[model samples]
Target chain A: MIKTKIWVIVISLILTVSAALSVIIFTLPKKNVVAIYSDGELLREIDLSEVAEPYTFKVEHGDGFNEILVERGRIRVSFADCPDRCCVNYGWYYGGASPVVCIPHKLVIKAVNSQKDDFDVVTG
Target chain B: MKTKRIALDAVLTALALSVFIIEQQIPLPIPVPGVKLGLSNVVTLFALFAVSPLDALLILSLRIGIGNVFAGSVTGLIFSAAGGLLCYVTELILYKFLTDRQIWVCGVFGAIAHGVGQIFAAVGVSATAEIFIYLPVLILCGIVTGALTGSLAQVSVIKLKKVFPFLPFRRKKEEKQN
Candidate 1:
């Protein structure tokens, strides 16, 4: 049987590595393009850098909807009808690796590197 | 013996459910979804070490199923079920390798598996592979919270065994043979 000290050291190593990785990922450079997805389908793609005016739009999925607010360089779910309101609480998406997600509504807003736009061209 | 086992399972299920409900009310500062203290897991951990693995599994399933009915959404159920299932399996496997004193190790790894399972469910439901970005932060949160809850389970198992020696704890049986 492995000793308890061995288990402690192993788990501590994992904990430290993940903590360092999280810091690195969070601090990585921000992107300019953001994609809005509902039920895996791309609903809208906005280049945050190009937004001249702030606006709010509603994306409805069945009985629920997310009110998304977009400013010049950031986007956020300003309101959501979902029970948890996790998306709205997520505050804003400013082109980070992490995407704002609402599991209930199957909605996700994520940053996309503009260069990759050619691969998955947005469809009307 | 069967009746005693059933009664114990029911009580542990209730305890897990109550913890699940109360945990929902405590607002977490982090806005990221699928992140919580998961204190209810303490009961499951205790059950796994002190009680039988079968008892642990029963209590976990009941807590996930009924707990969702009371305070969760349909989608929430899917996430909880996925996470709980993965976490239980991880703990079950680890249980054999570690002694009772090392239950905390099970907690840490089990919590990490739970995070991974939740991420898979989230990606599948949303159809967004980018959701993987949350993996690192989720794992980080899992380590911290898992350690806390695991230690809680370790202490509970030790103390509760002393207080209620009649309960069918696996450790008690092992001690008798030794």
Candidate 2:
């Protein structure tokens, strides 16, 4: 009986926390081309809207990680030496609910818009 | 006692590893990565109660090591190893407080702890806090799966002791009367 109650409490807590988190994550400001940092150094500024030509860049940062991405209109991480390979599988997420993530390598390619709209990727 | 326990642990680890591998072949409907049913945990729970704590640890380590190879991803291994270790530690703590019949509580806490560990790993690896958005969904899944696996472990233990009257957990102590 106690165990059941504990489970109930735990489930409710997780549900409550998850619901609040979803609201925060969804309502939080969003941006396209918010900011780009490589190896703790700012790389060339990215203009998501004006991207017309496809290009690839090599990013080796804190860890000796190799990353290659084919970015044209929509930026995508085409390849990475990271073992997880989640980012590679995420495949060109231009705009969506969540960011394309590669856990093994702390690399995030976010969609940003310069025109201040409803969401500001980061609450600045 | 030590050698017999080691042999038993080795066998249990091999069985759990096989289950872990077989489970991977069954794909998930959720697109999110690193989520699993972890049915192999049933065996781990059994080892925890039926065998010694060290034996259970051995089985868990072996399962995580071999299971990752079959999953074909090093990332999964990292997530599993960290999560599994955290869960095992929590289970050990809970096992002391809860009776054998109440093992389900241990399971629930272990599952939540596992989720927390995975999220911690995800945040560290991805370098993006935005991934935190998935936590709610993952937590719900964890509860459901954790409860299911916990119940499965409970039923297995109840039934096994019935069939194997000679099981160590039920063995009668030898008397030293004159």
Candidate 3:
């Protein structure tokens, strides 16, 4: 009896929170910048909107590196030495609540606005 | 008694490993990080009831340890280990108050704990509390997936007990029933 009540309450609560999360994650505006992070440190941030020339750079980490290929308004880890290469599979960053997390190398590539970045307070 | 326990745990560990690996092959319908069906938890849930909580913990740890080797990532192991330990510990505690039919409750709570643990790891590793943004989403997925895996485990325990009446775990259940 109590267990059933617990299930009902827990499920309802999760559903409510999930709905809210999805709304927030999906509705985020396309950001103009993306910050690449390795082992909790901000490696670099590219202003996608300001990229006059598409370029590629190797982001070296302790374990390995991710070859980040950037274009005018998008970014992606086109190559990496990590075993899974799931980060490279992330393809391109448009806009979403979820970032491109490179699990093996502990790198996170996330979309953000130039006005406000998530990594700003890290070093401070 | 020790041999029986070892044999059963080995089998359960294998069951969980295959489930974990195969589930990975099936691409997720959604692109959410730290979100998956978590179907392998079904086996852990089954073992939690079919054996003892201690045995369940052992099997879960073994599965996570070996599963990560199959996953081929060092860091992935850390994440899964955090999530797996949290889920196992949460369900082990919840099992006491939970009736056999209320197994899904264990799942719901276990999944929340799993997500919360992984998020803490993510936040610490990424050195950004902003990663907390994924918490609500992972928890939301945890509830749905945990319930599904929990219900499967409940049905499994009932059917498994009947098939293996000599099972030490089933003997305990019968003793309680009588």
Candidate 4:
């Protein structure tokens, strides 16, 4: 019991430090992607590049997961019906590192980039 | 002790698998992606004390294998095996020093260990550190669920001694049954 308590305290401290360190290390702003979100009532868009006007996607809002295509420039989750709005987490539509994920609504906006044809991981 | 050990462990493993399958159907209020109560671990705790360590390992493997198959996710098999292996190893190590009264702590640690193992598997599958963001949440869930499962296992250990007194309590009865 004494040993177990000691182990717990030590492990707890180690876990805390690692978790905090990871958060600090990974919050860097990623620049090469665009993310989008909208309700049937409102549409919001952001672009990877600081341009005068980003390309617009066409779509109508309904009570389900909705996707709007940004063509060759960039892509975003046009809209979703679910509440958590995880589609926003999937930051952009063109990189291997980030896949736009919508956790609450179970919607995803996948980025299709023509530059790289090879994928490093196959999630089986 | 040798032959009876095999049979008892087999039964406990099957029981754990049944509990795992049943618990899968009862949805949780919070829809965190991979969290679970692990109620089936009660059978594991029982087998740990009542049977030999080798027998306990067999039960753990069987329970994990059967649970994954029943849940219909072959992808989950790696996580189940890794998590189960870590939990079983931790429980065995904890039992060496702690008494049955201290089983709750073992349960807590087992849960954390299981979460760590699962995350390791997830990192491989997801291929992104973004998935690691959920580790703390998973660990908290592990501690909570581990304590619950541990308490239930403790109660079952006590009750089984009374109901099946001869099976668990008596050396003579064990010999005769064997």
Candidate 5:
């Protein structure tokens, strides 16, 4: 049986590492330009600054579809066929940090500088 | 072979699913997605300690399946399936080394594994590295929630073992004493 002391150490270690990682992630500079991605390909680039009217569109994959709503300076997944609408929950992405991700639809909507492009995709 | 085992699995599945459904009704104070009490995990931990691995697996899948039907979208099922499997496997592996008192450790492991697994699935399906930015947030949430659930499971394991001496957690020697 694993000792309580060992677990205590493990827990403390995890807590420390998580805290450090969070700090690093939060401190990173927030960028501009909301990019809509499907299956790792850059489907559309929406310049948040140039948006005149909000619009809705669908990103269709082999399995299902996600209806995305783009506003003046943000983006959101309005509807989805996947069981969990995580992307939808992403709400209005004003871009402090973090992107809205939909696993089933293979979608990621994030605010990054127009030049910051390169996605690390893991294959099944 | 025993009717009791079947009944137990069914009950556990129901319990986990209800916990899942109820959790959704409660408003999330945190705006971020995928953060919750994860109460159903307590039941899974209980089953892992009280029953066999296969039994625990059965309860887990049933909970995920029913949970998806009642409260989740298909996309959620995919993420949960990936995350939940990782959580179970982490706990199952840790079971061998952990003393009964250290079950919470398993909880922490399961929590981190869940985050990592979901991230992997998200990255795979989306085929983009951009989602990686959410990793730190997810991992931090995992540590907090895992500790809470792990501690709860630890308490249940300690008390339940006495009430049901037939549970797999009992050692052959301890069984004789009881």
Candidate 6:
């Protein structure tokens, strides 16, 4: 039988590695260009740094919709028809490794470092 | 004997479902989806080690199916099913290798597998690989929460056997020797 000590060591090692990786992910540099995707399609891209005024718009998907609020240097899901409202609870996205996700609607908003000339190529 | 087993399974299923629903009420500090204490897994772990794998599987499946319908979203079912299935499979395999003392190890590995399964499901439904950014955090959360639930199960397995000796709970090495 496998000793308990070995199990402890292995679990500890994984815990440390994942903890370090999480730190790296959370501390990564923030990007300014944000792309919004729905059903794997690029619906819109906005340069957060260039926004002169705050605006809100609704992205409808089937029977539900996500109200997106874009501000000067950040973006957020102001509201959503999805039951979980996890995307809305995500508060604000200022550009990080993690994307603002709405799983029910198959929507994702992620920050990109560089602007792509052709959206189709990026999705492809 | 068969009737007793069925009654036990029903009781365990109800216990798991209650825990699952109550856990949903405990709002998490982290708003990121799929991150929670997963306290209901304690029942699954206990059932796996103390009862039987088949009973554990039945309890887990029923809890996920009905629990989601009660407190989760329609799309949320996909994530729950994927994660729960992977977690149960991992624990089932680990059960053969681990002594009763090491049930927590099963919890750790099973929790990690659950996180991975959730990520796969999220990627498929969203059709965006970018959602994978949550992987590391999810794994880290899994390990911490898994250990807690695992230890609780271990305790229950040890203590409950004496309380309900009629149940076919496995005895620890020391208890077997005694």
Superposed on all Cα atoms, the candidates' RMSDs to the truth, in angstroms, are 12.1, 13.0, 12.3, 12.3, 13.3, 12.1
Number of the top-ranking candidate, with TM-score as the measure: 1
Tens-digit lDDT string for candidate 2 (A1-124):
2455565686678768876775675564543463445544555556554556777777776564545554534566777778778777877655434555556666666544434333445431
Q: List the residue pairs that clash in candidate 4.
A: A86-A101, A86-A102, A86-A103, A87-A102, A90-A100, A90-A101, A93-A111
Strongest candidate by lDDT: 1
**All candidates: TM-score of chain A:** 0.66, 0.52, 0.63, 0.33, 0.63, 0.66
Global lDDT for candidate 3? 0.80
TM-score of 1: 0.71
Task: List candidate 5 stretches off by more than 4 Å.
Answer: A34-124, B166-178
Which pairs of residues collide in candidate 3? none
- Give stretches of model 2 more than 4 Å off: A1-7, A19-31, A34-124, B1-4, B170-178
Docking class of 6: acceptable
lDDT of 1 by residue, B47-71 (tens): 9999899999999999999999997
- My TM-score estimates for the predictions, one after another, are 0.71, 0.63, 0.68, 0.61, 0.67, 0.70
Candidates in order have lDDT scores of 0.86, 0.68, 0.80, 0.64, 0.78, 0.85
Q: List DockQ for all candidates.
A: 0.34, 0.21, 0.25, 0.10, 0.31, 0.38
Report the Cα interface RMSD of each model, rounded to 1 decimal: 3.2, 8.4, 3.9, 8.1, 3.9, 3.1
Cα lDDT for residue A31, candidate 1: 47
Better of 4 and 6 by lDDT: 6
**Tens digits of per-residue lDDT for model 4 on B1-178?**
5566556666787788888889888888754456788777777777776555666787888888888988889778888887888888999888776555556667777887787788888888868666666677677677778877887876776567667755632211222110
lDDT of 5 by residue, B1-178 (tens): 4777788788889899999889878776754456666778898988887676788899999988889887648878888899999999999998887765666778888888888888888888779777777777777788888888988987887788788777445342232111
Fraction of native contacts (fnat) of each candidate: 0.69, 0.46, 0.50, 0.12, 0.69, 0.81
For residues A20-84, write the lDDT of model 6, one tens digit per residue. 99899888643379999999999999988788899999999999999999998889999999999
The DockQ for candidate 4, computed on C-alphas, is 0.10
Q: Is the docking of candidate 3 incorrect, acceptable, medium or high quality?
A: acceptable
